[model samples]
Structures are given as C-alpha cells and as structure tokens.
Target chain A: MMHQKMTAITALEHSVEIKAVSKTFGSFHAVNNVSLPIRTGEFVTLLGPSGCGKTTLLNMVAGFIDPSAGAIHIGGVDVTDVPVHLRDTGMVFQSYALFPHMNVFDNVAFGLRQRKFSKSEVTHKVMQTIEMMKLSGMEGRRISQLSGGQQQRVALARAIAIQPKVLLLDEPLSALDKSLRAQMQVELIEMHRNTGLTTIFVTHDQGEALSLSDRIVVMNRGQIQQVAEPIDLYRNPANGFVASFIGEINALPAAIYQASDREISLAIGNIRMTAPRRAEWQFGQGEMVQAFVRPEHIRIATSADAGCNVVTGEVLTHIYQGSHTITRLRVDGLGPIEMRLPGGDVVGRVPVGMPTQIAFDLSQVILLADKSS
Target chain B: MTRQRPFFVQFLVPAVLVAVIFAAAMFNVLKYSFLEFVPGSLNVGGFTLENFTRINRPIYYWVLLDTFILSFATAFFALLLSYPISFALVRAERNWVRSVLVVLAITPLFTGEIVRTYSWMLVLGSDGVVNTALKSLGIIDRSVPIMYTRVGVVIALVQFAMPVMIILLATAISQINRDCEKAAANLGATPNTVFWWVTIPLTLPGILSGFVVVFAWTMSAFSTPQLIGGGKVLMISNVVYLQGFSSFNLPFAAVLSLVALVAALGSLALMKLLTARLEQNMATS
Candidate 1:
C-alpha cells in the first residue's frame, strides 16, 4: 500500500521550470534573464534583499505579472498568459491577505465554493482543515477578532485547503514576532513534510531562507548569484555577493602568486599562504583576488602556530556574545579581521589593545570576486 | 449655542433644548393636521378622520402611487449611475482622473436642484437643444414633447439624485478592505465574481442609504416635477400643494403630507431592514 501511494505521489510530477525570464517596468529592469528548475516536492527559497526582484520572479510564477521575455512552465506546460485564478497556485502574502469579510471556515471554503462543491463536502473539508490548522471551534470567529498567530493559521488553511499544485510564500512570517516567527517556521516545515507540495518562498531574511529551504537561490541586483543546498550555499559561496550575504565575512584583498593544479597563493598584510583549490579558481598567477574567511572559522591564540594560515595582530575589541566571544583584531594593511571563539576558551583571555595571533584553515576559506564599480 | 468662555452651556443642557424644540415643532405640525377645514374657518376644536378619508379617492391614490413609482425609479437609476463612478473614484490608479471625477460629482451637488431642473428644461423641452439636435440628426421628424411628462420629471430627479448616491457610495466603497477582493480572486473567483460577490456586497450599506436618501428627496420633490411636468404630471406633492393653497383644502393637504411622510419613513425602514441583515452576516464573516 505504501509503495502504491509512493508511486502515485511520484506520478504527480509537477516540476516548475523557468526559462530565461525577465521583467521590466518601463525602462527599469526588475528581474534580468533568470532561469531556474524547481523539482516536484522540493522547497526552494529565492533569497535576497529588498528590490532584488525575488518577489517579482515569484509573482511571475504565480501569474500575477507576465514576464517581458522567455517563459514559465509548470509540469512542462507553459502557463505564461494564464490568469492568477486559473493557475491554481496558492500564495501566502506577507500581510496574509486573509479575507477580513470572512470567518475562518468561510475563508477556507471560498476556493471550494468557486469549484461549486456540494455544501456538505465543503463543510466537512473546511472543518477538517480548520482542525488541522489547530483552529477548530474558532471557525466562526471573525478575522479581526482572532490574534495574529490564529489569523496566520487561517491564512495557511485558506491557501492549503484547495491543495494547489504549488505553494508560493512571499515573506509570510514577516508580520509575526521573533518567537512566533520561529514557531511558525517549524509548523511550516512540518506542513511541507506532510503535504509534499512543491513550495517556492521569497524572503529577504537570510536566516529564514537558510533554515526553511532545502535549496536557496541567492539573488543580487535582480540576478541570481548562487543556487545550491543550504549547507553548500553557506560553505561554498560562488561570489563576493553570496559570501557577504549569507553570513558575516572577514574579507581582504590579496594577489594570487602560485596558481597550479592543486593549489593557489594569496598575500594579505605581508603574509602569504598556499591555499588549496579543489578546482581552478579561474585566476592566473600574479592576479589580484579577494579571500574570505568567516569569523567562526578563525582561531585566536597567544602563541604562534606554524604550518597554518597565521596572522599576528592586536585585539581592537572583544565582544562577549552569550556563548561566544567575537574578538576584533587589527592587522597591518587589513583594517580588522574578526575571530569568534567559544566563551572563555580563546587563549590568553582576549583583551582590548593586547597583541594576539589568529590562525585559520586555508581550505575553509574561499576566493571572492571584486565587485568595485 | 454660545461658545464664549463663561457664556458656554453644558452639552446635556444644549441637547435637551434641541430635543424640546424638535418635539414642539412636530407637535405644531400634528395640531395643524388635526384642524378640520370648514367653509370660512378651520374648526380647530373638532376631531375627525374626514380629511384622511377625503384623500382616499382613486385620483389621489393613483397620484400617490405615481409619486412612489417615480421615487423608486429615480433612486434605482441614480444608484446604477453612481456605482461605476464610485468604483472608478475609489479604484482608478491615476489621481488626476479621480480628482476630475470628484470635481464633476461636486459640481452638480453645488448647483441648486431648481437650476439643474431648469437646465434640463432647456435640453429636454420640445424646442429645446436636445430636440433640435435630434431633429437635425433625422432621428425624429419633429420636436419631441418631453418637458411635461413623467420622463422629464424622472430625468430631473435622477439628475438631482446621482450626486448624493455617488458621494455616499464612494465613502462606502472606501470602507471596504481591498483585501477581500484580492482574496476572492485568489480563491479562483473571476474579476466579475469578485466585484459582484465581495465588492458589491460590502458597499451595499453605503448604496442602501444613498437609495433611501434619494427616494425620500424624490418623493417630497415639488420644484422638479412642477417645473419639468409644467403642471401636467400630478405627483402627490403637486396634489398636496393644490389642496393646501389653490383648492383651500388644508385638512386634505395635511393628510396627503402625512401620507407622504409615512411612505418615506416606510421605505427608509425597509432599507434599514435589508442592510441590517446583510451587515450582520458580514460582521460575523
């Protein structure tokens, strides 16, 4: 029985393919030649800052806006001109966009009514969905009467009640408090697991995107810079934008010296290191390149460690986070390189203006592109 | 009413004074309605239903019905005209177009209804501009007589009624949360369905009052029917005027005015009932 159900689910096969899509508002381009393939039942997040056209791309997929060039296909069928109502794609807007004129039950039942379902079937399904959303007896309550969390649940129930082929979320948890947002994120993940719906979420919050998405599509200036799984995206960013966008990075400009089959060289502040390159970093020898190492990857020590990428500097400031210490070190030519260490575990008990030595793994660092205008 | 320091009255005192004046004014009308009319004098001492019975004739009844029919038709036509204007004013993307429409809506309201009616007379009369244009266009062989007909009165009433409906409907449509329309569309409702189901239902309260106001105004209208009908269309207001001033039947005129008041009040009550039920469900939803 489980095998049959798995096969049936596999037969559902509705992969979304976006082909060279671009959207322009008059003379200004909002999305530029972006292509992506979202596999069935895979949750993909289009992550970027405001005005990055992540929302525009999601809107095009929802059929709210037509792409200026190229096409969008759902399950291999082009639905470029299809209106929003015919697309059968569920969207959870940042504002929730729940019907203020409808109760929870009526809000959930709206799509069913549009399909002209029998009254009993609509009532039964609405009841079940409302319960599944943990809003049972509150079905008769007005939207304004419910709390923000309950209202969000009602909005989720409304969107998922129809069981559309794809679920689209546009910063749906933005209105919630931090604690509630974290809780709702867990609920959303559980919901995705239960339904196995292909979901595309657009968010400016990197943490939200990284935590929720199986794969993250990082965008900058309406162009996709990187698309990979959460771990791969965080560990191996493709460019300077992705490196700086994902997490805090201590980057310094360095000239490549020894470019070879398995290794490359970068010079930073009278210090040179032979960094291993799994593949060619696309730069010849004697070329300027930027190396980025995250704060957590750098180890601060009082004693010099040989055979490691070591840099000696003075501690500018030591910020005590709850369980960690972020020590800001001032090195020659490099203004500041931060080293985040476990609380009270950093050697020599970091003090402001005290001399310190920091060492990091060259293998863990990445070369980034220069984005100066 | 004084607003000066130390010359100000308390809110409750002024409110009581206003209520007392209202009661006295209504009592005076009631007393005048009860006064029986004799040959040379009104018998103020007598109590009788003779005036009410006098207005029960088929001629008066038909004229009263005509007034009611005219009121309903004018209100309906005004509502129909106002809906699209209100929708545009509330939904149009361009501010200039909305502002222009608003100015157009306000221009009609600022003009007195009599002036508007006179303007219509110039347009709709036999030798008026509209008839001349129609004749020139070969749509009609001769001047079309319209100034003294029900159509003329209806046209005048509609002209007067539309601005009120537009203002009220625009205010009502503004109060509707736009999210409801988006929600309707998201739920697979077509644009037309969203408009009819969500937009219209939400704005019904606003348009409902617009209808009642226009209906009451049209029912009590004296100048429009008098000027446009040219003493031909005998609406109830005309009948009341004839009884009170021309025919010297004060009692019958009072009875007719009372009937007019009752009709207006009844229609308002019906409007209230219809909208109240709809709003109750809407509130819960």
Candidate 2:
C-alpha cells in the first residue's frame, strides 16, 4: 500500500511535496512528521483550530519557517534550505502588510521590480493585476487611504502580480466584517479560478475551508487527520475530531455494534437502532463503536414513529436562527442532543422543560471505532 | 446629570509656576541683550543694538559657524551610532540582550554633564586611552592631538547625545508592524533590501525627531566643548561664557545666548515641517 501510494504521488505533477516535515519548539511539536503532496493548480486548505500547526505548516511552505526535519520540494526543486526571498511563493499576509509608504502601483510593482523587470513591463503587469483585483484607479492612493477591503485586494494584487509558482494565503480574509468576508470569499474564488496558481490557504474557519478549498486537510494536534474533497470530508470524516470540528453533531455514548450483511445494529444506553449496512462497515460484529448524528438528520417524532430509534428527552433550550432553529434537548442517557428544524416554528411548539420524542434518521449516521475502549 | 471632572487644573499649577519663573528669566535676558555693556563694568547703559552689531564680525561669525557645524556633525554621527543599538535593543530575541543594551545606552544619561565631559577629556587627552592604545598597536607612533580640536569636541558631543537618540529610535522601531518587513522579504526583497526599503523609511519620523532633538541639545552644549575643546574650538556657548565672565560683557553674552536659543527653535520648526510632510505622504489613518 505504501509503495503504491508513493508511486501514485510521483505519477502526478505535484507542485509542492512536503516530505516528513516536522518543526519542534523546545519539546512542543508545532508540526509533527507529516507529508502531503499538492497537485498543480489545486486549492488546498490547512484547516485546524489555533495552535494546531496549520499556520506553521503554511509558513514552512512559504519559507518563513524552516522544518527541523525533512524536505520541501516546490516545482520539482528541493527548496527546504532556501530563504524566503529566494522561494518563489507569493504570500498575502493576514494584516494585508501593504507598504504604507508606497501607493497601490508601487506596492504592486515591488516584486516585479525585485526580479529586474523592465520599467514598462512592471507598469503593464501592475496595471493588469490592479484591474484584475478591481483596484483600477486607486493606484495613486496611499495604503492608509484605501478602505479595509480595498487594502485586502491590494495585498492580493501585490502577491499575485509576480505570477509566482505558488500562492500562499494566510487567513487573508479573516479581518473583514461578516458581509465583507462573504464578498471577499467570492472574489478570492474568482481570483483563484482566473490565476490557476497552486494555492495553499491556512484558516481556522471550517466554513471558509469548506467553501474555498478543492481539498480540505483537516488537522488536529500537529498532525493531519484527513484530507478529502469538501462533501466527502463533511459526510465521511475519518475520525471523531474531524466529524465534530467540521459541523454540529451529537456524539452518542459508546455503544455495542452488531453487523450483518444486510444491516448494522447499535445499542446506546437502553435504546437500540438499526442502520442499513454500508459497504465500508469494516467493524467486527461485537466491537464497541461510537455513533455521530448530524442535527439535521434527527427530527421531532410524529405519532407514526414506532421504532426503537425514537428516544424521549426534555427540551433544554431553543436557539432561533434566521432560517433554522436549533433546539437542544436533554436525553435521559445521552446528555444534550441538538436537532435543527427549519424556521422558528419549533420554538413555539417545544417550550423549555417539555418532554418530546426525537427520531434519528439512521441512514445518515456516522460510526467510528470507540478508541477509548 | 453633571459629570464630575478630575483635578486637571490642580495638576497644571506646578508647571504654570515653573513657566512663569522661566519666562521672567528669559525676559531679563532679552532686556540685557538690548542694553549697552559699559566696558569693564558690571552695570549696563541705555538700550542700544551695539551687541547685535558686534555679532557680524568674522571672529564671532566663525564661532557661530563652528557651533552649527559641530552640532550638526554630532547629531548626524549620534544618529548613525544609535540606530544599530536601538534596533538591537528593540529586536533582540533574548530578553537579557535587550535589557543589557538598554542599560548601557541609558547609563550615560544618569551621569552629570560635567562628569561626562571630564571623562571624555581623559579619553581624548594626549597620551589618553585612545592615543595609548593606538601607539601600542603601532597604528600611530605619535600621540594624536585629539584634545582641544573639533574632532575631540564632536566625538564627546556625539556620545553625549546618543542616549536620547536611542530612546527615541527604540520607541519608533518598536511601534513598526514587523509584518511589513516579512511581507517585503516575501516579495523577493533580500534582508538588506528590506532594511533599506521598508525599515528605514518606516522609522523616518523617529530619525527626524531624534536628529532635531540631538541637534538642539548639542547647540547649547557648554562643558563638553569647554573642557574638550579647551578654548581652541570655541562654540557659541563657550564664547558666551568668555564674554560674560572674562570680558565682563553681559550684553554680548546675552545676545549669543539668544542666538543659540533662536537656532534651536528654528531647527525644531524645520523638523516639524518635515515631519508633517512625511506624515501626510505616509498617512496612516
């Protein structure tokens, strides 16, 4: 399997290959021994909470930080020891780090000028990038004169103006307001599509990771948990961390699992539920397993419900979101279980301290091996 | 409801008292500059502009020119030496390194001006530490005459002005967003290029203020030039002292003092104008 995977990695035209890269500060491992190969023109995101080594990994790729062990290959060249200036990676800093002394044109022209481009070529490229970033007439304006979103665009323009081999974005949209953040996300997508540059973005926001990345590398505790496409990652997380980190889900208590060719049965507390057997169900018949169910999959039980999947609980709280209401219920043995219903109608129907029955949509459940056992 | 205010007026009382006394002393100096100095007498005659006219002579012109040149050189050299120390003080990765640099940079300020000037004399004198070291190293066979020279005066003055320059520069450098430098490097600027293109321009305000402050401070320098220059390199301050004490021409001394004061104020105004233009150019909202 390892040999096949290695051959597959070598067969593709990977733009960046991180080989067993690790960085340790004193005894704390910021990035453990990890390897990832990014294909050309791929938009990859390192998604994890703060201090989980996502930014550290991105910085190592950008040549801002060096790995204590292992090699980084960019464009088929070993650039592990290369200094940041020599590393042909364009980076947009989170603060937008636009030169306050220079106007938009000069700031965008800086990288081109460093490469010894001709005066007219620098002007042409800068103008083209500014136009692409929609910063057309603001070339003469100082960075401080531009609005926050405009400054962000200028930062992007400055980084991409050089047409680098790889573009690295370090949480570049995190500083904007909610509305502006949504706007910039669309612009970022458009920019990525237009440039087709192999980009690696680092962000702790799972929503951004899900929306922006071609492949999301979910990470935790200085190691990669899983790397998959957006829908596959959200639907089939490799572990409990990725499942809970990606979206809201309820982790039922450790349960006994019994599987057959046609169906898989799980016993949680005194409640029993049966799910249609998936081809990927590789657990032993009597193994201990944990079940994760998304809030949307579980709903209020109607009178027609007569199965063991139905559980009784008292409503704890109702959080009314604009399009949906998240109702929290304290189950007898399962602690708090959250169910997402469409609209605020659930708030008037289910008051606090009222007992109700919630049925799990068994087909949509996610089962992982209970490692604690 | 009426808001209860803090005692801001009470806080200004001591400062106002000091300003009043300072203004009275300055008024007395202005009055003396307009009076006539009776030769060899302690008293002054009716108001006249003779003292101002005496300032146009080549000898006094040389004194004023020397003072300006020395002060400018001191400020320039002090800025050069202080910049590296200040950068290290602010940017050192180790806390102890920053602490050591701060202590060394500021320890000179605690010493009295007379004491510091006397110490420089010992270092710059014939057969002094520098001369003896050079002679022993065979770099020079003869003891170089640094004492009573413009070089000696400037060297002493530059050292004297560095503590203030470092403090101002450290503050400016610490306030810089380091991400700017990192971004410059990420855009293919070498470390050297980053320093010149980003770091230096970002600290221009601090540089301007430090230069002006050192310039003004060095203009009124008295004991450093008096002791180190030893009457050979006469600055306006030393000339003011000579006229007041040796020549007993209080009016002439007051006129020189006024000129020094005006020169300092004029430099500060120029600095203000330059900084305003800079702030406008690099307008950080």
Candidate 3:
C-alpha cells in the first residue's frame, strides 16, 4: 500500500506551484516575488511573524486574493485567473468560518451539494468525513452549540470533505487556547498523515511550525527567508531573523579573526571563540558576523575544563520550566546569555549572582552575516 | 457614590416631570376616545362608545385596511431599494465612494416631510418631471396619474423610510463575518450562491428588523399621504387628521389615533414573534 501510494504521489507533478507570485496594495507590497513548489502530499508550513505576507501568499493560493504578478497552478494546471470556487482549494480560516446557521452535517456537505452530488452520495461522504474528524455524534449540532474544539473539527471536516487539490490552513489554531491548540496540532498531524493531501499551513508561531511541519518556509518582511525541513531549519537557519525567530538564541556580535576550511576563529569583544566553518558559510577573514548560540547548545563548565570557546559569567537567574531549567547568566563582553539544562540539574548548583564558567558547543553554533557587512 | 447622588437627582427630576406631562396628555386622548362627539364643537360631551361604533362602518374599515396595505407596501419597497444602497455603503472600497453613498442615502432624512412631499408632488404631477420626461421620450401619449393615487403616496413613503432602512441594513451587513462568505466560496459555492446561502441567511435578522421598523414608521405617516394622496389616500392618520382638524370631531379622531397605535404595535409584536421563531429554527437547523 505504501509503495502504491508513493508511486501515485510520484506520478503526479507538484500539487501546488506558486510561480514568482507578487501581491501589491498601492504602495505596500504584501507579498514580494515568492515562488514555491509544493510536492504532492507534502505538509509545508509558511512560518513567519504577523504582516510577513504568509497569509497573503496562502490567500493567493486559495484564490481569495489574486496576485498582482505571476501565476499559481494547482495539480499542474495554471489557475491564476480562476475564481475561488473554481480553484478547488480548501482553506481553514483562523475564525473557523463555520456557517453558524448550518448544522455540522450540512457544513460538511456544502461542497458536495454545490458540486451537485446526489443526496445519498453527499450523505455518505459527509458522514464518512464527520466520522473521520471524530465528529460523528455531533453531526446534528449547530456550530454555536459545539465546543471550540468541535467547531474546529467541523471546519476541518468541511474543508477536507471536498478532497481539494491543496488544503490551505491559515493559522487555524491561533484562536484556540494554548492546551487545546497543542492537542489539535497533534490531531492535525494525524489527519495530515492519514489523508496524505498536499497542505500549506500558515502561522506566526515558530514552535507550531517546528512541531507540525514536514518542511517549513520561514518568511520575513513579505519574503521567504529559508525553506528546509524542520530539524534542519532549527539547527541551521539561514539568517539572523530565522535564527532568532525559530527559538530563543543569544546573538552576540563577533568579528571573524582567521578563516580555515574546518574552523574559524571569532572575536567577541575581548574574548575569542572558535566555530566550525561549514561549507555553506561564505565569509572573508576579518568580516563582521553575528554568532548565534542556542540556549541548549551552551553548557555549564568549570574553570578546570579546557576549551577554546569557554567563557566566565555570573549566574543571573534560574527559571524552572518542569522538564528543563533555563540558567540565565551575565557573561563578560557578551551581555546576557541563557543556557538550558535538562531537569533541575543546574538549579541547585548555579546560584544567582555567583561567577560560573560556560562553554559554547562550537559545532552547533550558527554564524550569520551582519547586515552592515 | 454620595457625591454622584445630587447629579442623579437633578437628571431624574426633569425626566420624571416630562414623563408625567406626556402621560397626562395621553390620558386626555384616551379619555376623549370614549366620549361623545359634540358635532361642530371643540368640547366633547358625556362618555360614550359612539366614536368607536362609528369606526365599524365599511368606509372606515376599508380605509383601515388600505392604510395597512400601503404601510406594508412602503416597507417592502423601501427594503428593496435600500438593500443595494446599504450593501454598497458598507462594501465600497474607496473612501469617496462610501462617502457619496452615505450622503445620498441619508440626505433625504435631513429634508422635512412636508418639503419632501411637495418635491414629490412636483415630480409626480400631471405636467411635472415624470410626465414631462415621459412625454418627451414618447413612452406615454399623456401623463400617467401618480399624484392623488396610492402609488404616489407609497412612492413618497418609501423614499421617506429608506434612510432608516439603509442604516439598519448597513449595520447588519457590516457585522457579518466576511470570512463566512469567503469560506462559502472556498467550499465551491459560486458568488451568487454564497450570497443567497450565506450572506442573506446571516443578515436575515437585520433585514427583518429593518422591515418591521419601516413598517411601523410608515403606518403612522400622515403628511406624505395627506399631501401626495391629495386627501384621496385616506390612511388611518389622515382619517384622524380629517376628523380632528377638518371636521372638528376630536372624539372620533382620538378613537382613530388609538386604533392606528394598536395596529402598529400589534404588527410589530407579530413580527417579533415570527423573527424569534425564525432565529430559534436557524439555531437548531
């Protein structure tokens, strides 16, 4: 079954192809020259902050907003000028947009009814979809009568019942409470896995993007910053924005002192640190760059430990976060830095206002080119 | 709380005084409705039901029925004319377009009813704008009778009620979740389908309320029908005017006024019951 599904997926071209699309509103450019090809049955997320044009791009794909330039194609057919109803793309809005006057069954059957499906066909399909969405018993319930989570499920069931060519989710979880949002995220992943439908999700929450996406397209200022798998995106963000956006990172201004094929020496104020010079990094000797270090990548060390990237700092505060603890420190010549230790490992040892030695795991450090350079 | 007590007293005093005076006036009218009319005299005679019994005649019955029909027609036509204007007022993209629509829709309210009725008379008269324009275009060989007719009175009343209807419908249209329309379209519903299926259903409450308000407002209309109907279109209010002022039958006029008030309130109550049932049905289904 898996083999057959793989072959079926490979037999079709990209499910949705955005060809250098641009949307401009008078003087403001909402989305600027963005081109992305979504593979068949791939879950790609457009991750960015608000006003980053992620929703604009998704709206273009959904045919709600037309691009000012370039074209959009679904299932290898150009649908640039097509109207929304003809495009066959399902969108789950942030507000859910469930017809308040409609029951769950009718909402799910709306698309089928519009397509003139026979009565029994619509019933069977809608029932199957409602069951799949775990909304079987609530089929007769009105939208307002359901809980928020149930309403969200109905929205998903409605959108997916049509089996649209591409499912575009525009921050569908933003309205839910944090716990509900997390639970729904897991359900969404399961739903995506079962359907194997090409999906494009848009969100401002980086943690959501990291958790739920197969590949994340990080965007900023109406432009895509990088497109990579979730693990790669977290470990190797392309720019300072993506680095800071994906997770908490201590970005210290550094100057490259010496560059070699394997490693590069960087100067942060009076302190010197060495980081692996990956093949993708292109920087000249003595070039200014921002060294990004994840909180978890920085380790607590002692003065007896010998390392080329070790620094001494005073422990500022230890934040207890159940599964992990974040030890904040005021490092010399580097301002404030945070280190994440598993459990309460550092809680009793790292006292506030006391001097402590910290080490930067050189291999995991990310170096981004400074804008001025 | 103590400091605010005197200010509350000051505000309450005038409102209470005004309420007492208004209630006294209504009490006088109610008392007059049961009294015997002294023919050709301002002073009423002893208490009697003769005025109400006089209203039971076929002539007065027909006039009451005509008033109800005309009011219903005015509200229906007003809603029809105002819906597109309201939609445009709320949905127009440009600031100038919205401003223009707002001004056009609401400016009729600024003109007094008498002035507006006179303007309508000029427009609907035998040799007026409509007749002259139709004559020149050769659509009609002679002037079509609009003045002193039910059509002319209904037309004027519809225009009079349009501003309030437009404002109400605009509020409804603006409050609708725009995402619902977008979602409908995304679910393979055409624009027309989306409008009928989603937009209309969602704004039904607004449409029903606007219709009822205009219906009640037009039911009590006196000037437009009196002037445009040329005293021919006898609405309940017009009958009351003729009895109270023209014929100096204050008792009969008061009875007519009370009937008109009861009819308007009764219709509004009926409409409220219907809309509540509709909303309940909508919620369940």
- Number of the top TM-score candidate: 2
TM-score of candidate 1 on Cα atoms, chains taken together? 0.81
Per-residue lDDT of model 1, residues A1-373, tens digit only: 2244345558645578899999999988899999998988899999998999999999899888899998998866788988878887788877777766677788899888998889999998788878778899998888778888888888888888887777889888999999999999998998888777789999989999889999999998889999999999998998888888998898888887787788877777678877787674688777777888899988854345664677778988777786988888888878888888887555357677877777877778888655561
Predicted candidate 2 versus true structure: per-residue lDDT over B101-208, tens digit per residue: 999999999999999988888898887899999999999989999999999999999999999999999999999888899989999999999999999999998999
Query: Predictions ranked by TM-score, top down?
Result: 2, 3, 1
Model 3 lDDT, residue B9, Cα: 88
Model 3, clash count? 0
Query: Per-prediction interface RMSD?
Result: 3.2, 1.0, 2.9
Deviation from native of the Cα of residue B279 in model 1, angstroms:
5.2
Candidate achieving the largest DockQ: 2
> What would the DockQ be for model 3?
0.52
- Residue-wise lDDT of candidate 2 within A1-373, one digit each (tens)? 2244345445449989999999999999999998999997789999999999989998999898989999999988999999999998999999888889999999999999999999999999999999999999999999889899999999999999988778999999899999999999999999988887789999999999999999999888899999999999999999999999999999986565678898898888877888888899898876788899999999999878775589998999999999999999999888899999999988988899999889999797999999998
In the predicted model 2, the residue pairs found to clash are: none
TM-score of chain B of each: 0.90, 0.96, 0.94
- Location of the lowest summed lDDT over 10 successive residues in candidate 1 chain A: A1-10
| Residue B103 displacement in candidate 1 (angstroms) | 5.3
Candidate 1 has an lDDT of 0.83
Query: How well does candidate 1 reproduce the true complex, by DockQ?
Result: 0.32
Models sorted by DockQ, best on top: 2, 3, 1
